[model samples]
Target: MKKPLDSEVFSSMLDASISYWRQQGKKGVWIKLPLELSNLVEAATKAGFRYHHAEPDYLMLVRWIPNNTPDVLPANASHRVSIGAFVMNSKREVLVVQEKYGRFSGIGLWKLPTGAVDEGEDICTAATREVKEETGIDTDFVEVLAFRQGHKSFFQKSDLFFICMLQPRSFDIQKQASEIEAAQWMPIDEYAAQPLVGGNELVNLITKVCLARFGGTYNGFSPQLTTSASGKQTFLYFNGHFP
Candidate 1:
């Protein structure tokens, strides 16, 4: 819908459309409202509309007419969040482990230590836990270096991964025998030169980026804060956009 809606008549106009859609045997109705028109959107909500999703430019509102309709919003719409530890020691060697299971199993593809984030888990803390579990090394998360998303993750669930830059506090590699075939502190140059990584164009590119940002030279991504007019705490940044 257009911006600067006629708020005075929008409620009536929306109600009339809903009534028409119901009489015409329409199963559902979707109304796209621009992000600025919160008042008009609230009017539609009282008229029995529910949210589907929100993109940067607009918000999606869906209305299901049928009483027997299944949920319009998916129950499992959430993506699985995981963290990867890009741990480095004093010698600038990165911690990597060979997978004994999962997608890259038995292929000798070295990857940073990673695992699924448990419920109520702090992302930074989870990074260290995964490193300990896989490599038997104590590490401290310094900052988030990068992140990636996979739309077609296993079982068709979406995946969100955080690549954390960590400082290795303790040494002595002990690979988790079950899931990890071997773990080691490979020199960054040697790790990047591996055939499995170097031959793969994308992996090699990412390895270079990680190596470039190694150490605290590329640190500090802390979110800025702000106070609302109503004396409430609010995030200054939303979905990568500054308000």
Candidate 2:
């Protein structure tokens, strides 16, 4: 059910659903809960549902009716989330980096610094870390400029791509020895005309979108990780990250 009513209504609905699905003798049912419906989420869980995979905005909860079946999630639901930085310098040049090894290792396709988000990493923080790792350029993340998801590219595995706009603070391009071949601040037009950057439809559009959204302000949000003397890591989102 889409965002259900209040908890009482949802409880009645869940009761009816359980009665009906039990009569049908089917395998299972899935409750897709938007992140906003934490109350309903709790209600569902209290009704014997369990956690499943999650998307950027939605949470999936599942319950198996079959006595023998393990709760099987959608096979394609496992998507890896990643971040890319579109860093622009005061000179109007964007930070581009060449990977030491990848699909575009030697093809000379300079891309916006991109990397995988760690298990507990914050999105904007990941973007800034990726930029610093790939190009040795320190940046303050502005905001998420654009996102693209596709299964066409990677062995039918879905990928979530967050392209962010960042302000360049430090300029030296000390490329990471292991992963980066080289890094440079290239003129926007010059960067776009290149093969990989220009040829890929999603990449091209996100770059354009980032450039278009550059001047306009965006209130950036990132999770704050704090460590105490006891050696524990705590993750907290900006509560109201985006204004």
Candidate 3:
């Protein structure tokens, strides 16, 4: 009789085989190895599979499981009043506001004209109100594109992002003394080059989302984590950190 393969060796071989098969676009390959393959069994378990015993070898079985459906946002959700906006102009430049107060101060970075969604107001209504209050621009039609939440943060609040198309209106850009320092419309390239208050990961996610909508590029959104100087870690898009 042949000696059984070592568990460690079996695991390594299994991993390598899986990688090769994945690269080749092959699906659902199983391995029958020895019962002494403890490491292989553990790895298969971690990969959402179960192991069974066969006559001379252990049977490694894999099953495809669909991801659980995400929970639906409450119709009357009153978590927090955070908001983000995507304001585009006739010149193809997007309007991003600099946060004057809070943790993102003096960053010279760009962000959507957003603020808290007031109590007793719908997200769309709150978005319109925030834009008007922040940038002095009144937007009539508000459309929500995506919703985001952070894992954890300093502020301990949820951020709601809306993709809104503005109506034809004329107004002067003014900064609210209490909240914003400066406001401007910058081209996509210029905005992309500027540093982001939320960090590089956030900027990348926002860029991908915007490009997919307006620039015909469709890379999906990637979440980010930002750790502040004060040792407070906040999940970007899920919450805001205020200094």
Candidate 4:
């Protein structure tokens, strides 16, 4: 609100707006309430608004104006996307790091350079960027080898973690000081011998897949740049090598 009005005036204005929207045949109405204007929530609810979603700075409320039609407003994002770079060099060594934080911290588990995908970032770009950021190793995005989906993770939201195969361009390691405790190019065989890898079923499967990819016996989803009907540029990932 530009100026904080008393609940009486705010309710009056809300009623007028709703009437105007109904007259215009609007199907959905959304209102964003700033944190400072929380006192107006009661007025909004009395006018037939319900909670939609919320963020750190604001609360979003919505109302379906057309009673005859179903509410078709899309839901907020329900999944977080992350990536793990399976970067291999010509020396048969995979880039790995010991994070200074998270579950792997202080456990001596050497894992791939991994990070969450930033807003508006593509999966392939996220993999390469994560590798460069954590290990200072430049890499070329190859393909998305595999992905896992898990529910009830990270604030009760589902998560998609993609395993990306990347070919290293520059092998020099300059570990991120704040997040990575140590980083190195470890022999793939030796890296797979770690207790964490040998013990976990999922990790073992991933290791085998990486070996298969290295041996040219496996293929993953490759990104093809394409434009939608709306003329927006985007990547369509699929098995491009298929006949």
Candidate 5:
């Protein structure tokens, strides 16, 4: 809808539209106002519209018309998903990288190849992709070893980090020059003994879990192909190895 020069006109039109929608049994109403039309926000609230979300350039307002039912609108995205690859070779060497940035930078801490999952990308695929991008090592996704959830980590948003097990298909390390300071195959024992890994409780536990998987004493969540209710094929991750 176009922004009106007069707030009184916008209010009248909004009221009329709401009444018409209610008469037609419409349950939900959304109004998006551009920054230039912010003057209409007060008019919208006066008409019972509440804030749904906002961006730098716009504001979204919502209202529910049905008195018998409750509002069921979903909120904006609350969590950012990331993936870390734990790749161990037959010789007990793990693929590790030292990032040029982030908390572990300049500390000489060799950590797993990790990156944020892209939109519409599977977690398993993300793990392999991060490994390939950071180290130039080809790998096959195995299973998710574990996951860590932390609040207010990035931009005041919650974080979900999935630790995935990957099998190496190539051994050469060509570290990403832009982001990685170094990448190599470090021995599992040495990787686990890192001061940074041992200092952080969650990282230490994750390292142990990776070791357990390597020792064949622990099984991680594996993905199985399945069809969703919408007739879309997707992967459902779980301990499907169990009987």
Candidate 6:
């Protein structure tokens, strides 16, 4: 005789199924089961679960666990939110800018075009806008590469770095007079030799990985500091531009 599905057994099966879907990269669970399992479905729903499909034979369920961790911000040194872009060119040369003002000023360092993500602004949007403003080159593709957290700061801070591919024949570049002092293209090996702004180790790691995969020119430069409206300190760095 076949074994019947009990509450404990059903719940365990559901948990395993959810885990399997997540490992496969699905965002949420969508399931269809025999209508005979109505009692089981009711029990699950009563347990803080919800379903999607309308068909009686199929059930869709979602059980969300909230993330209680506080979002990190930069000025708080207690928390920070920053975004970076790796802009590369076809000639194996990356675009880099020299910092004309703030913290690591006048130091010849190379980095991606990056900046603090403003409150209420999407990270990718902020990155694209910052790149255009800093290097006068608009990007065509913005692929998120990695996210990292700083270990030493009293405030929690995170960096969102992206791989931005530039448009062909779009190198008519100019620096923002108020933020960047100079902008130009240089070979990847040469650009890597300069000191990085913001003294970041995470940025360096992202650069190494990108170089190994794409094998193209890298770009961007050290971040410059600017005072926020709330009187907090923030830094901006650009990796490279896509267009």
Winner by lDDT between candidate 4 and candidate 2 = 4
lDDT of each: 0.78, 0.79, 0.59, 0.92, 0.90, 0.61
- lDDT by residue (91-168, candidate 5, tens digit) is 999999998988889989999999999889999888988999999999988999899899998888899999999999
The residue-by-residue lDDT of candidate 4 on 1-243, one tens digit each, is 645668888999999999999999998989898888888899999999999888888899999998899999888789999998998888899999999988999999999888999999999999999999898888899999999998999988999999999988898899999999999999998999998997899999999998999899999999999999999999999987557
Model 6: per-residue lDDT, tens digit, 49-105?
676444545555555433353322212224456766667788888877777777646
**Which is the winner by TM-score between candidate 4 and candidate 5?**
4
lDDT of 1 at 190: 86
Residue 75, model 2: lDDT of: 46
Q: Write one digit per residue (lDDT tens) for candidate 2, span 50-88.
A: 887687888888887766767665543457789888888
How do these models rank on lDDT, best leading? 4, 5, 2, 1, 6, 3
Candidate 1 lDDT over residue span 18-93, tens digit each:
8888789898788888877866877888889888777788888888887887755444356889987888777878
Estimate TM-scores for all models.
0.61, 0.60, 0.51, 0.89, 0.83, 0.49
Candidate 3, residues 18-136: lDDT per residue as tens digits? 67766776555445545564446666666555543344555545533333544232222224646677767667777778888886778666777877666665555666677777788
Clashing pairs in 3: 81-117, 103-243, 149-238, 150-238, 153-234
Q: Flag clash pairs in model 2.
A: none
Reference-based TM-score, model 2: 0.60
Off by over 4 Å in 4: 1-4, 19-27, 34-39, 65-72
Winner on TM-score between 1 and 5 is 5
Model 1, position 97: C-alpha lDDT score: 93
lDDT of 4: 0.92
State the displacement of the C-alpha of residue 9, model 6, in Å, after optimal TM-score superposition.
62
Highest lDDT scorer: 4
